[model samples]
Every structure is written in structure tokens, then in C-alpha cells.
Target: MAEEGISPSRQGRPSMTSSMRSSSFLREHQQYRPPSKPENHYGIDTVVEDLQATSIAPPRQISPFNGIPSPENPPVIVESGVSHELSHPNCTPVPGTTSFDRLVATLFYKSTSPRVSNAIPSPIRIPSPPKRAKSPTPHTESEIPPNMSPSSSLDTFPLEPPTTEPEPLDHLYGSYISPMCITSFLHLMSTFPLPPGSTDLNSAHRCLKLDTAHGHHPLVVELTMAPAPSLDYLSLSDLRKHELIYRFEREWNVDVVLRSDTLWRRYPRLVVFDMDSTLITQEVIDLLAATINDPPDLAARVSDITHRAMLGELEFDSAFRERVKLLTGLPGSIFNELRPVLDVTNGVRPLLRALKRLGVKTAVLSGGFLPLTSWLAGELGLDYAHANEVVIDEATGRLTGEVKGRIVGKERKRELLLEIAKKEGVSLDQVVAVGDGANDLLMMEAAGLGVAWNAKPRVQMEAGARLNGDSLLDLLYLFGFGDEEIRTLTR
Candidate 1:
């Protein structure tokens, strides 16, 4: 500085260090040199090392002129002080590259973009899934317009295409759900109105169509079609309405009319008979003992055990053993002799002929012996027969005091009844069961109509219907059979 030349110690700064230096002097003397490029040696690793080393060192003393807070003992206020100083006028951004304005604009109006408008707005409006067509509205008699013809009405509406999606709202709320329920509903609804050109008499007997959305169509109607009563021949309309009711009762409710007319007029397609007492008067076991010439005391014991076994009191095997033990010495030849002595009950041939002529499937499922039952099945033209076999001692050719194979007990009998119905291609409701013992209870319970034909006290109590005074033909009556039909069936 003494000679106004560059000093060796002032190599880091320009000579115009004094604040009183004029702007012109600074501009004239200042040598403006562009910054030279640094050597390409400091990499990301070197920069990280430098930063870590600096972070470990004691903080540098901040200048008051810098307007930054002091670095106190713990330096707790350093971050806050630096943030505050940067927010002030001293911390200006570099020009052209740094954009504080753009950042602020982004923060303020982020959601106002057109991209967001293209997205879904409400959660509910997010497309609804397609649904299946609803079940067709059930048709009632009232739904048929009085002047419209059914054929014309049918032609007016084409069959709807089947829906592929899940079921629609109406089906989720409709009352007529099942096929059976729809059938019953339509049947009941038919009683209300008659279609065009349909008389009450014709409408009462005609079948009605039941439509469903799920491709199920069925015809529902009464099982029988009979002429309606003539108002002139049985006129009681002038009398009190109750008197008309009584008069109708007098015509329809007469036993002779129902028994001799209605029931025999409407015969069933099937007839089933119980083996023990219905087809045969005496229980097969009693005839077996009589043929063996066993003592009365022993025969009575066997009968008691047989009864208990039939009533489901004792296990079939156990009861059978107990009964056979009494006949241990009885010869096997007695079975052949007993077969003929077995009492064929009254109305046996006539009942079988009637059932066969009616094209009815007749079966004999008994808790009795197979030999006896199979013989009867063959003789009576029975469709099927299932029963137990008595085990004989092979060496002695006499009773072994045991039963072989499955015991046709109550439960087994019930199983056989179902199997028969299935094999015969008949509805369980069309099958008939007739029995006279307590053991027959389960089979009776399973059948469509369980008739106790002159049954024991136990059997009569459990059966659906009872037949005492009438022959086996009385079963025809319960099936809506009339005397004319019964006569045709018998013939």
C-alpha cells in the first residue's frame, strides 16, 4: 500500500478496502477477473464427507451485521435463527433459475387443475353395476282384463330374454318366491276372476299358467274336474244364504254321495298294503310257531317278543334271537309247511286285482321273513318286496336261533319305502303305506297316505287315516275315488 502497488499479504482482497473509497476509483482500479472452473475432483462422496466434517465441528461465530441470531452454548436457536434470517430481505434468490413465485402458485391452487375435473366427483356416481331383470309380476285372475282374450293377450307380449346379471330389485322384494308358492298363489288367485268368454264352470276347472323370470313355467290347477251343481235342481237362493249353504252340504256331504260317488269316481294310481295283518290275517311268526307244534307257553313268548320287536322296543337282532331261541329244536321243514298254513287275509285277491288293474305299483315291505314275503309278493303281482331272512343251523337243518343279513326293522322299512317310491318313479306324496303294528309307525309316517287297516291300537293312533268297517278297497275312497271308478278298477 506504501507504493500504491499490490502487497504480498493483501493477495486475498483488493486494495480498496476502506469504506471511504469513491465508486469511480473502485471501478477504475478493480481488475474484473471471471471465476475459473474448479478441478473435477470433488464428487458426491467428497461433498458428503465435507458436510459431515463441518457438522461435527464447533459452530462459527455469527456477525451481528449478518442479522442472524448468536450461536449460544447449546446452539438451540440456530435452525430457527437461520430460517428467520433467510425469510428477511437479506436472503434473495438467484435470478432466472430459482422460482419462489411458481412454488407459491402451486401451493395455493393445486386442486384447480383440469386433470382433477376428469376424475370421478362423487363416490355414489361412480358407475352402478348392471343388474338382472326383475322376476315377472305374478298374474292374478283380476289382472286379466274382462274384455281381453287370453290368447290375444299372450300374443301381445313376447317372451322376455333371460337376464345375465344379478337379480334386480323387484325379486329382492316380491312375495311369491318359490315355484310351489307361485303355484299355490296362482291357484288361489284363479278363484277370484274369469277371463273373457270363460264361464265360471269352465274357469273353475281350467289350469292356470304361472310365469317366473328365472325360466320356470308351471301349470297349476285342481286335480279333478267335475260339473258344477245346477242352481235349478238344488235351488235355495231364495232362502237365507246359510240355508243355501245347508242345501249344498246336503248334496255334497252325504256319505253315500262321497263314498259311492266322489271317491270311487276319482281313483289313485297306487295302492300299498302292510304285510303282517293287512295282506295276511295272522302274523307270520304265529303261523311259524303253530306249524312247529311248539308248546303254547313258548308260542306265546315268541309272539310277545315279535310284538315288542315290531313296536321298536327291542333291537331287531336281539328280539329275533330271543324269538328264535324258543324254536331252536324246530325243524327247517316247518317253514315249507308253515308257508301254506299262513292265513291269507280277507279281500287279498280282490284288493290286489284292483290295484294291478289301476296300474298301481304295489310293494310289500315287512319286518317279517323274506321267504314268506317274497312268496306273497310273487303271488300278488307285487312290484317289490323286502324283508329279513331267518338264519338256520346248517348242520342240524333246524332253527339257529338267529336272523341273517339286515333286520327289516322300523327304520329299515322306512328306507325301503323311500327306495321303492324312487325306483317306481312316483312322488313320495303318491306313495301309500298301510300297516297294523307299532313297528309300522315309521313307514306310515314317511308315506303320502298312511292307512291303518283294522290296525292295532298303536298303529291306528299314528296313521293318517283309519279303515275298519270297509275292505282294503276303502283306500280308494281316501284318494278321491268314486264307486264307478272302483268298479272299473276291480273289473
Candidate 2:
């Protein structure tokens, strides 16, 4: 009799159908031979250029995921752009958006690897292996399941930002380090007084560990002859749980991030800023629309579109096109005139300076215009900027009302965040994205931490953090900075 899982056809001697199936599988695989010989098939010139990029680069700090590259697996090379499959699996690499390092494991593996010469890229080329813990069915050449595609089973999963949640104490303490501002923490400590042995915050920059505060259990003072405590706390674990973490957030009026110390500090290696109403006081497009006052009706029409777009009522790209079309007759001089009055939000200058001091990388990713994003980067001391280009009619010296490049919309913002983080050699979780609009949400959610700064209600509710304060400098407080540190820096 056939076993429960075994088919009757395969239970005894191999059936005729089984032999036919094997023959068919062999026939299918025989056709999948290398498309071309390794000597000259693929773009060796691009490969040579990529090799040159790594050869010149200095040895980089190894990633936390895989300290060293795996000998067997290599970075995938999809020279031809990729269309994300319907699944959009972690292994799939989105052209222009997929981080080089993030695509490494998925891109290059023996089973589905592209035939490349021995000269492989480095640093960006090391993917340890697929990091998923779940054991799925093994991949076979004969049958390419969508989920097991080379794009889906990359050796390593795309690293996601680590989240804080209820977990064991040992694991939490392992990643526990600093960044909870000393001033606020100390203030809480004075009232709460830490358990006998845990963390000491007497130092300025980092917290020193006095003791791990382990190897003890407790009985309430009411049951035992032990002395009573002020806050009615028993064990050190309780202190971290109920007081330092939970109550501290409420009393201090700040969200305490409970993530890996290394990842958290590393992050914000790239801090992406949204342009309109975020990095700038005014939407440049809206400002441009207001530039044409002679045709009052056109200006009002454009302004209405701009207002609706900013309010998340209208689509940004279409609104942008319509607004630019209104300015078609306006001379390019209007942009220059508007540039001087273009205020980089009231407190952004100092905030940018403070970030520089912290060694955090900053980027201005605007859906506005490349002209403005680039100019703002210069004034704000930002490291990078990205946005759509505004094509001008050289003959007319006026707006063309058309973008020369791809529109920097919601998906593009998210992609830029990933690209910037990968280029900066940091994980997405180690980055911070701040924005105030609907377009900003995609990028915001992509970062290690998302901060909503006086944003739309939908955004505020979804962002990881929110700042409803007077100055952008208050952002320092989110990193745990106290009043004293903020004043000294500003002064």
C-alpha cells in the first residue's frame, strides 16, 4: 500500500509517467545553458568599471550582518533593469532603488548566478546568505517557483530597521546603550533613583554600566522585612520596564527609542528632509505660481492646485505640471528672485549644524525641483540632495512646464532613502527621515526612524516620532539632548 503522502504511481517500481517526467525535466534544464561564454558575453566594460570603483576604495568597516564576505555567494549583477515582481519579495532588486549591498546575496549565487569573470566587486559585493530563519522548500532548476526565484532566495534578506518591543531582558540589555539624553534621564533618575545596580549616567556622552542588575529576584517589602523604596519598585527589571522606559516617556514628554545602540547611533548616517514646508518655509512650486501676478486668475488657479496638493487633496506630479505650465511665460529670472526670499525653515540652519556636529549625514530629497533642492543643500550644509529637474526653454528663457527626468514622487522618495543609505554604507534602520507631507510618508516609513514634524494628521499618526514644537532644533531632544546641551550648541 502507498504511504499517506506517497502517490500509488511512485509507491512500488518507478512508473512510466515518472520516467517521462524525469526526461521532461532534463530536457527543460538542458536548454538553460549559459547565454554566452564568460569571456565576452556580458558588459565586461561595466564590470571593469565596477571593479575599478572597489579597487580604489579603502577597506570599509564590515557590516554587522556578515562581518566577512561568504566565499560561495557573491553580489548579484542585474545590468538590465529589473521590474519588481508581483510578489515584491525581499530578494527582488528594484532597479535604481535597490541598495547595492542589500542586493548582494540575492543577486549572486551558484544555482542562479550570472556568468561573470573572476573579477567580482568588493565591499558592496559581500552577501553572507539569505538571512531568513524559516526553512522553505529547496529550489530546483527544473521548476522555478516564483517564491524560490533567484530574486526571491538571495542569500540574505534585506536588512530592516530593528524595532523595540516586549522581549527578554537579556536581549534588550545587549542592545541597550545610550542616546537617551543625559539631562532628561538624570532628571528622571533623581525622582526614580535606579535600582542598586544597572546603568550609571554620570558621564556626558555615554552611559557607563555599573552592573547588569541581574541574578536577583525579590519579595515586596510588605511580605518581607526589607526596607521600602520610594517609587514602590522591587526588581531592577521592573525599574527599566515601568519607570525608566514607560513612565519616563510620559514624564519627560519624549519618545524613548529602545533599539540597538550601535544601529541607532549609526543611523541617521542619512537624514533625509522633505522640501516643501519641511526644509523650506514655502513650497517652491507654489511660490513660483505666485510669481505671475499680472494674470491674477492664473496665479490663483495655480495656487489652488498647489494648496490642494500640499494638503494631500491633489496629486503632486500633476499639480506640479499644471503649476509649471502656468509659469510658462514667466522669465527664468523669477526663480532667481524667489531664491533669495526662499527661507530654509526658521530653525533648520542650526538644526543642520547640530547634526553636522553629531557626524550625521543629511540629505534634502525634494519632489519640488532640482534647482531648489541643490541650492538648499549648499545653504544648509547638507551632504546630498535629490529632486526632479525643471526643464527651461533655452530659446524663450522661460519655464518649459515639463520635467527633464523622472518625477521625484512618493515611490521615488522611498527609493532615494534606500539608495542614500546604501551609498552611505549604513543600514536603513540606522537612518532618520523627517518630513511633513503625504509624499514624505513613503521615505519616512523607509528610514530607521520616521519623524513627523508638524505633519498632516495621517502622517503624524503613522510616523515613528512627531515634533510639534516651535523650533526644528527641538529635534535634538529626540536624540535625548537636554536643554543645556541644546543651548550650548545653539550658543
Candidate 3:
């Protein structure tokens, strides 16, 4: 056998046959590399064929900085195991390192390692991601409770059972009802023992969601309960039960009012409002108390009493007297100063304007003195204004600290509401009362719809409905008026 070494060729040049064999040995023992093209997919057979057919090419010195093939040695394109040499293009080369260079280096150059298997490792079997959980249904069909006990929290009036079949609910003043609120309220109602008239808690209830222009949500929903002669206002007492209503109000922070759903309730002939805190932001008595500086902090002391009176902690008559006694020496001219400065509650002007446009008669029944109430009534174009009279001493030119006429306490407020309703020839069921204190509760109860406007806790508990929202304009919503409708009416 011939010596396994470089032998002299015919041209006196050392033969490269031995060096070629060494290169092949090195490549076979080198670490296996993957394909250059990311898109190239190879089975085990393809990988093995590629490894076997790859030819060793002459080493080309690639610039470390540019990673470009030298001009003397151009790129080799392999097609079907056949090498085709091509010159580098004249155009600017790709900026970054490419996979072709890497492939060429791997096939031609040798690294110190044993030959790697040609078989492609089993393709990674990644588990598919888990399915997402389904969301709960928005409205669940609530089951009616067996025993519907009457709530005993409110002093509700005796509602005469309908001797005739219940009337059709045509004129319904529906408001946007929360599904959560309705669901929760129904759940609460389930706790009550089934009253005689109501068939099932869920039987006659209807809920609808409609798109509206006025509210932020733009979606208006109304919950309509079937009329039940036995269950009035969801109360327990045969005499007066406000428990369920109060619990609903306290728990949900939303009012639960049961209406007669009559045309009269829908288009009320008269709407009465408490002047202080309801129409105007400040209590007129509290403002009058500020005029007395001789007692030093008399305004502060009287305001405390006024607060107590509004909260039902003190009797309105006695509290009025006490607060008035503090204002005995205050000048009547102080009313003038208070007139311009009195901050009206938000949305008052718009609400009144809308009510007037709707052909509804409006009134102000204030616990405050007549001067402010009458002035406010005149300013707001109210049809009627009733309030307590303050006796002014003609000689002293100051307040006498005595009421001239009958004190307009809780009973008087209710009386005034009834009187105004009668005077307008409007039925008692066609009157709407809105107020913010304990004194207003009686008036609110007597009216067809009694709205507690951001009232005391006790008042909120007792009133037919309570609204704690920011704007008085929201009252229009209770009348089943959309934003666009209210705008048109007001305009």
C-alpha cells in the first residue's frame, strides 16, 4: 500500500489528496449544526442526506467586523447536492450577519466534537393551552320565597284591597333599574311569607333595558312588579310596615318605591317641594341665625338645633321656637342680604323649568319664614308658597322671636300639601311631594309619590322613595323622561 501522506504530483506540487482525507475526518467528528434557513423543515431522512452530501469547501477568511465572504472566494449555492459558485453582488450587502455564512462555516469548517445524530429529535410536543372559564349568566331566574313576610320598617298607610280586578298598568313611570338591585331586592322579597294577593315573587315582574340619551350609562332599565292588593309598598304591618322598603334602601343605596302606576302618578297635576335644603342649599333659619352676632356663635348653636330637628331628634315646633329665639334681635333687612347669596341646589332651575313646561303646577312649602318662601316662589314662578310667619316688631324694627300664625310643623306641611292638591282640583293621587327632612315625611306620605331628596336617614327610611344622587335634575328620570325628552320639555 502507498504511504498515507502528501505525495509529489506530476507538476512538482505536493498533492492535496492526503489533506482532503484529513479534512473529511475532521468534519465527520465535528459537532452537528442545524439548517441556516428558519423556514427549512427536515425529516430524519432529509437531515441524514444533507449531512452525507455536504462537501468541504476551501476556507474563506471572513472579516470579523463585516462577516462578509472575501472577494477571492465567493458564496456557494447548493441545489440538490450540486454546488454552484456565484460572485458577490455589487449592491450594498446586508448589514447584519446572515444564516448562509453560518451554514457554509458549519459544512466547510470543522469543530472538535464527535458526529451528531442525523435524526431530528422528536418535534416538541407542547401541550395546548387550557380552555377559558365561561362567565356567569347576567340575569338568573330567581325563585320566589315560600313565606313572604311583610317588612315592618316603614309607617305605611292602609292600602284598600282592590274590590275589582287589578287595573291595566298602562301609564307606568319606569326608571332605570339595576339588575343587581332588582335581583337583590327580589331575593329580599323572597324572605317574606307569600301575601294573599301576590301569586309569586317573580310572576308579574318585568325588566327592560333601553338605550337613552340622558344618563352616563345610556342604558335605561325599569323593573315593573305585578300589582298586589295585599302587599302595599312591600311592607309587613297591617297598620304600617316599612321594614322591607327600608332594608332595601339601606342595603342597596337605591330606593325601592312601589307606585300605583296610574296616569295621575305619571302626569302629576301638582308637585310640592320643601324650600330649605331642597330648593335652596342653605337653611333659611340657619342663615338668619348667622345675623345674630350678639350671642357669639349663635349661628353655630342654632344650626345644631336645626340639624337635630331635621333629623327628628327634636320636635319641629320647639326646635323652631328655640332657633327663632336665638334670632330675636336679627334685623329684617338680613333677608335682603341672604336673597342674592342663597345658593340654590344644583339642577333646581332646570327641574322647575321642565316641570312648568310639562304643565305641572309647582309649590314651595317651607318650614322657613314666609319672606324667603314667598320670594323664592316668586323667583321660581311657583304657583303656591306656604311657610311659617315671623312676627316683626314695627317699633323695634327687629324680629319679635314669635310666630304670628299657626306654626308650619310636620302636620301643617302635610295639611298644606293636601290643601294645594285640593285647590288645584287634582286628586290626592295626582300630587308629588319632594323634601329633605323629617317634617317632609308626612307630606311625602300623603302625596302620591313622596321623594326624599338626599334626606336624613330616618326620612329616607320612611319616604316613598329616596334619591341620593348629585343633581335634582335626576328627578326628571323618575317621571320617565329621557335626557332628550327633558331637554325638549325644558326648551
Clashing pairs for model 1 are 263-481, 263-482, 264-481, 264-482, 264-483, 265-481, 265-482, 266-481, 266-482
Q: Stretches of candidate 3 above 4 Å error?
A: 1-182, 186-220, 227-253
Q: Residue 255: error of model 3 in Å?
A: 2.8
- Clashes counted in candidate 3 amount to 13
What lDDT score belongs to each candidate, Candidate 1 first? 0.55, 0.59, 0.66
Candidate 1, 16-69: lDDT as tens digits: 556846658666577983446565656556565555556434676432233343
Which regions of candidate 1 deviate over 4 angstroms? 1-270, 292-296, 308-317
Worst 10 residues of 3 by lDDT: 101-110
Location of the lowest summed lDDT over 10 successive residues in candidate 2? 101-110
TM-score ranking from best to worst? 3, 2, 1
Off by over 4 Å in 2: 1-267, 488-491
Question: What's the TM-score of each model vs. the native?
Answer: 0.45, 0.48, 0.57
After the best TM-score superposition of candidate 3, give how far the Cα of residue 288 lies from its true spot, in angstroms: 1.5
**Deviation (Å) of 119 in candidate 3:** 66
Candidate 1 accuracy as TM-score: 0.45
lDDT of 2: 0.59
Work out how many backbone clashes candidate 2 has.
Answer: 9
